[model samples]
Target: MKTGTNNKFWKYAKIITFLLTAFVVILSGCVDEEQNETESGNTTNNSQEITGTTNNQGTTGGDYIYGTAKVKSIQIVTLESFPVQVQVIAKGYLPDGCTKIDEIKNEGEGNAFNITISTKRPKGAFCTQVITNFTETIPLEVRGLKAGNYTVNVNGVNGSFELPVDNVPEETPGSMSTKQQIITEADNGTSISIENESTFYLKLKENPTTGYSWELNLSQGLNNISGEYCPPEQPEGIKQPLVGAEGVHLWEIKAVSKGNQQVMGIYKRPWEKVTGKEENFILNVEIV
Candidate 1:
């Protein structure tokens, strides 16, 4: 009876050990599979992180953004009391795989404004990997704020501008309507006509913060186009240029009167002199 009982005890012990070993192997496999899945789904985590960061833009705290998105320019539309209005514009040279803006967010109050934008690839997409460029404008408003200094944040860019109590008119958006025509630097050696009235726009690369700007030197026939034109003056084509960054300095002149004239100017520090007028231009004009 003792021998039989001992044999039964050993048999039971071996069975328990084998079962325990099988269970451990199965558990280990499940654990490894879970780890692999987590690794493969990291892109989801990245996207979630971006969403969180984007929500933080116009706010003080949130996730910091990561990517190539950036603000290209900003303009104050109204700094006076009725309500503060600003126009923030941005641009991107996206990778070929990206075809459109995926999201856009703007937040904050009169004192601070934040803007965020993102681009994405189309779903089930077949896209060529090429570089492309795009431009976008974000209009922001803060109600009931009077003239004062304000902050604007576009994506991760920050800027400070004042809202003056003075009321100045802005330029007519690019005109193809009236007898007026808009001309640029590209028309340097060409001739332009003004039967009714004409607005001539001369643009060049400039850095205003460096005290370097373009000024129109009216030479009799051509008059300057400077009557309350574009209060919060902005460069026609260049988006948010930095303080010392290069941008297009647009100069305008309204030609009214008949006969021939010339528009001339130099790009330099106002207090300096232009010896050869190397950085200058002489544009021919005709008014009737």
Candidate 2:
């Protein structure tokens, strides 16, 4: 009877041990599945965060390329007033919708106004591939400039404007005098007499873009005070003058002594040898 009881106890213990082992295995599988699911969710969220950061950096950060805009033309507008007010209108097209005007810089050096127009776009970004037209009107600082022809370059597109008279106000000292005379192309070969120490002006037509300018030859008793070139004036209802148009060269001269003074001008390029076939202007002056 004791041996039977011992066998029955062993059987029941084995059955309980097997049942415990199966239950532990099932519990371990469920825990492992839950852990894997949490890890997968974390990986997906991290991927989204990384992608968002990259896009934000591309748009608002310093990840961009610099370029120049394609300028088609430029219009120089002059206001009719003393100390001329001038503005330049730049017309161009952007290569893509993503491209934008980054900066515009202008500085006057001698007779040229250099304008730099820069553009920027996001790096490695997809954008609309359509061309966008843009117009920028920029005012020029012409308060201290002398009367003459001035050239403007906007992104390599060239245009010119003229200051017909000195940009200074008429009330400025020595700006106007009663002893001054005006000379024009129509006055060529004409004899004129003026008082000693008197001043005179000569306005001659010239086209520097063709490499031709008026070379002046002044005789004794005459002194050249100053000179400047002025581009052609824009007509009424006209936006701008054509590129490479003819302009005027204004020369101020003073009669120093009383004698016969002859003025001669030859239109030719300075680098070329003087040929008699070139155009010439002759003037005779008598200073008393």
Q: What is the TM-score of each candidate against the true structure?
A: 0.34, 0.41
Model 1: per-residue Cα lDDT over 29-120, one tens digit each = 99999998998789789999999996556444422333545445554443221223456657656766546666877887757887777765
- Candidate that scores best on TM-score: 2
Which parts of model 2 have CA positions greater than 4 angstroms off?
A: 1-60, 170-288
Worst 10 residues of 1 by lDDT: 75-84
Q: Which candidate has the highest lDDT of all?
A: 2
For candidate 1, the lDDT comes to 0.63
Score residue 163 of candidate 2 by CA lDDT: 89
Cα RMSD to the true fold for all candidates: 15.2, 15.2
What's each prediction's clash count?
A: 4, 3
lDDT of each: 0.63, 0.87
Stretches > 4 Å off in candidate 1:
1-84, 166-288
List model 2 lDDT by residue over 1-288, tens digit each. Answer: 999999999999999999999999999999999999999999999999999998887677558889999999888877443456788989999999899999999989999999999999878869999999999988899987888999999999999999887787567663443536667766778977788888888888789878999999999889999999988776679776556766888999999989899999999999999879999899899888
